[model samples]
Target: MADTAGDSCQNLREESARAVDNAKQLQDSAAAFISRSGTEEQSLRQRALAAESTIRKLRSSLDASVRRGTVDVGVAEKIEEELCKAGSIITDGDVASFLPSIDHGTFLKMFLGPINVRATRKDVQLKVKEEYNRYRDNTSFLFLIFPSALLLLRSWLWNGCFPVLAVQLYQAWLLFLYTSLALRENILRVNGSDIRPWWIYHHYCAMLMALVSLTWEIKGEPNCAHKQKGVQLFLAWAMMQGVAMLLQNRYQRQRLYTRIALGKAKRMDVVWGETAGVEGQLWLLYPILFILQGFEAYIGLSLLKTALVGVVSEWQVIVCGILLVVMAAGNFINTVETLMSKSRFKAKMKRSKSKQELDQGLPPCNSRLK
Candidate 1:
């Protein structure tokens, strides 16, 4: 019995040593892999920056010529259009080809869903960009349509002229849309998008609210009193959001286009539409945004009160109310940041243009020259 015990002890010691050796090997391998990944990321980003710098130099030359009155405004814009093509080529060939697949891209494919079949890392990133563009376009359209329809036909809707079944179906549609958009945004973040984390959290919150609201009983007398009023309020919220969406869609696209033109952003596969004309429009947009934000806050507070007072004591309502307030705050903050940044950029550009003209033996303005 002693001899048998000794042999068993020796075997266990050998197994333990082997396991430790294997673990050490794995640790070394993981460290080496991570080092290689960092090196590759650094190299690729440097190359992209070099290419971007070259593009910016060319754009600046054209801009300078425009400021000096040597190039026609229309001609400079055309040149910019051509330069956008060059930017596209570089993005596709140089940058995209070199990028590594991020962890979330693989996770996205494994779990929720992928909108496209992406065989390579570049393919995944491109697909993410494409899907995001499509999602934004869809939302812009839906926000306008649903809100306008609800508002224009509110009286009829209140009287149950719109079938409960139809309303439910529309809500389902919205739920699907919001959920898909959130997933796509996650995938985009994985693909190197600079989307704020707060926005992503906001989407998650919205999806949860949508899901909970779907379970809301919109018909029948048992719980119809408060429930129906909630639905009506929701419609009004949607209408307010619709106006905000339209403004954001139009203004933000133009801002993005301007950024791309200035070489601050990678060019997208879309036309640079008519100029934003934002200089004279801030008075209109800001007030509208402020009103919308206030309204959203009021609705969220009301919902919270109802839930807290046990007027409609579903846990989902409580959670959704909290989420609504959070989302509204996030939205407002993001909007303000964007507006401030754009305003600063425009001011700087104006100052630079004026300086350039002065340097070129021209006055800052006709009145100044006179």
Candidate 2:
């Protein structure tokens, strides 16, 4: 009993020390930020002070959690996330503009009601998670719904019915999907999720394309001789996206499960479907992804060519085409980099296993005797 009590006390002390260290680091970061801002020095200093105030509140909450003899992992993670974001603002000149908004938001809550500030912060964090899950659920539903709906709609629209309305609906759907994706990506980033920046950038470009498509007129618009062709191409792209999402949702979940089993990922997100896997990627995921990227590029170039030939003179169409090409190039490069990294990692792991077997003076299992 006494040993257990001593160990618990030591753990508490360690946590307290960590909180202190985090506080000191935050102070240093804020000081550096204040020194760096030239004309906006005062405003920057005020924002830093606000961030420091938030850090202190977080430390207090941590202390309370520790004293209660039950640390909330969620709270701890939130604190860490907020600190990282604040630190980034302080150190990264490119993101310094965001500090003002952060400061304003943090201070506004504290000023409105100091006593409930912690509760308010916790509520906000919980809401972020809730909204993210909601977004994912909606995306999965739409991924299935949109392609099927478009496929059916295409039959009617291709014949003599309301082609303008059909085109408008399609564009609207794209806008919704891309906007939601961009918002979700931003939320994930803010929550300190380890999503690739390239993926977020991809969503940004996609959103741009969708926005441009919103203004695209089909029937009555001039230079729209290839409108029907464009519709067919977009429908094909939509169908491909649906299939790609289905495959990705399945294989990525399995990959996450494998990662968790191998002590790679900490845990799987509960929103995904049931998963079963042991090790190594499915290989199928990459081929599907490559195909989707290729399709996107092909459709984009086709649209660009149509625009160049005066079939569509709108700048929005031109810009959208360019963004699609950019996204395709970025996706390809990113995918290739990921594949190479995974291969290298697998090779390293195999070498380590072989070394262990050799150290044990046992022939590799694949060896044959003659």
Candidate 3:
């Protein structure tokens, strides 16, 4: 009986030792797997970057060959499509999970200056844009109030007295606002956000005007009266512009979301202008934008008229007026161009759908009625 009990205890001890050995093996295997995963992650990013460089070079060469008539146009186009697919894979895949997907292009670098504004992750890049949009909305409302209040003080409380201090402070704020907007837009361009170039240029013009406004001399009482008209016109225009901006950001963003859900817009794309693709909102947004543009041009012409009639001949007024007119024209052109492009896109889509239906032996819905 004693021998039997000893043998059973020995067997138990052996089983316990074997269990511990198996656990140790599993721990070692887990450690190896974790190390290998880390190495592969790093390797993946490096390979993707290399691939991107090679692909760019290949594309450049192909473009040059096409331009020189060395490659068949059809073949070149098909190759370009394949290259684009490969590029998209790298951009949208885990390769960029912890790395920057794009550099600030030369265009943005010129505006943003020499610095790396690259974000580490996709979410961070998107958050920067979201913050900029919010900033624009808040500041636009504030700007609207500032000019409105200033004009009221000058007309009622101050009895047409030029509020030099108040006006100059407003100019300073304008400078700061434009500068911040330019910086944010440049950063957005760097982070693969597609911002319209003219919009950024408009801010540049605004910044210049703000600086000029700061330097303008506002003479006391009687001398201020003639120049006051120009200043007042500018103020009114600014107020209208602020309102337009608020409406633009609100409706454009809403339109952007709707299109994204409908698969009409890319996830990375944001609204570029006041003109939205949605019909229900366009009825409300475009008229206001057109009116604002007209008002801007009118103010500019008025300033020019003042200068011509010798009411106010300051270089500042002339420059500001020209800038304003130029901005109005550019905004008008951009809006029209956007509308035309959208129209063409819709027409193309309709044609494609009709062709597909015919190929499938299905008559068009309109044809069914006929």
Backbone clashes, each candidate: 0, 1, 0
**lDDT values of the candidates?**
0.68, 0.62, 0.80
TM-score of 2: 0.59
lDDT per residue, candidate 1, 1-370, as tens digits? 9999999999999999999999999999999999999898788777877877888899999989999999987578789988877777665454654544445654356655665432336655666677677677677678768856764564664553344665676678777877787676666665555566666677677777887777765563565556555566667777777766666666767766786676666533321112222666666777777677677777787788887877777776677677778877877887687678777988988987886677678545675868
Which stretches in model 1 have alpha-carbon errors above 4 Å?
Answer: 1-93, 105-131, 147-154, 157-167, 218-225, 268-277, 350-370
lDDT of 1: 0.68
Between prediction 1 and prediction 2, the one with superior lDDT is: 1
The collision pairs in model 2 are 223-311
Give the C-alpha lDDT of model 3: 0.80
| TM-score comparison, 2 vs 3, better candidate | 3
Compared with the true structure, the alpha-carbon lDDT of candidate 2 equals 0.62
RMSD of each: 13.0, 18.9, 10.3
Residue pairs clashing in model 1 are none
Please give, for residues 92-143, the per-residue lDDT of candidate 3 as tens digits. Answer: 4444453454566664667657677877567887788789878977987997
TM-score of 1: 0.61
Ranking by lDDT: 3, 1, 2
The model with the greater TM-score, 1 or 3, is 3
Residue range 29-83, candidate 2, lDDT tens digits: 9988867765475665577768767776877877788779688664575776677
Model 3 TM-score, 2 decimals:
0.73
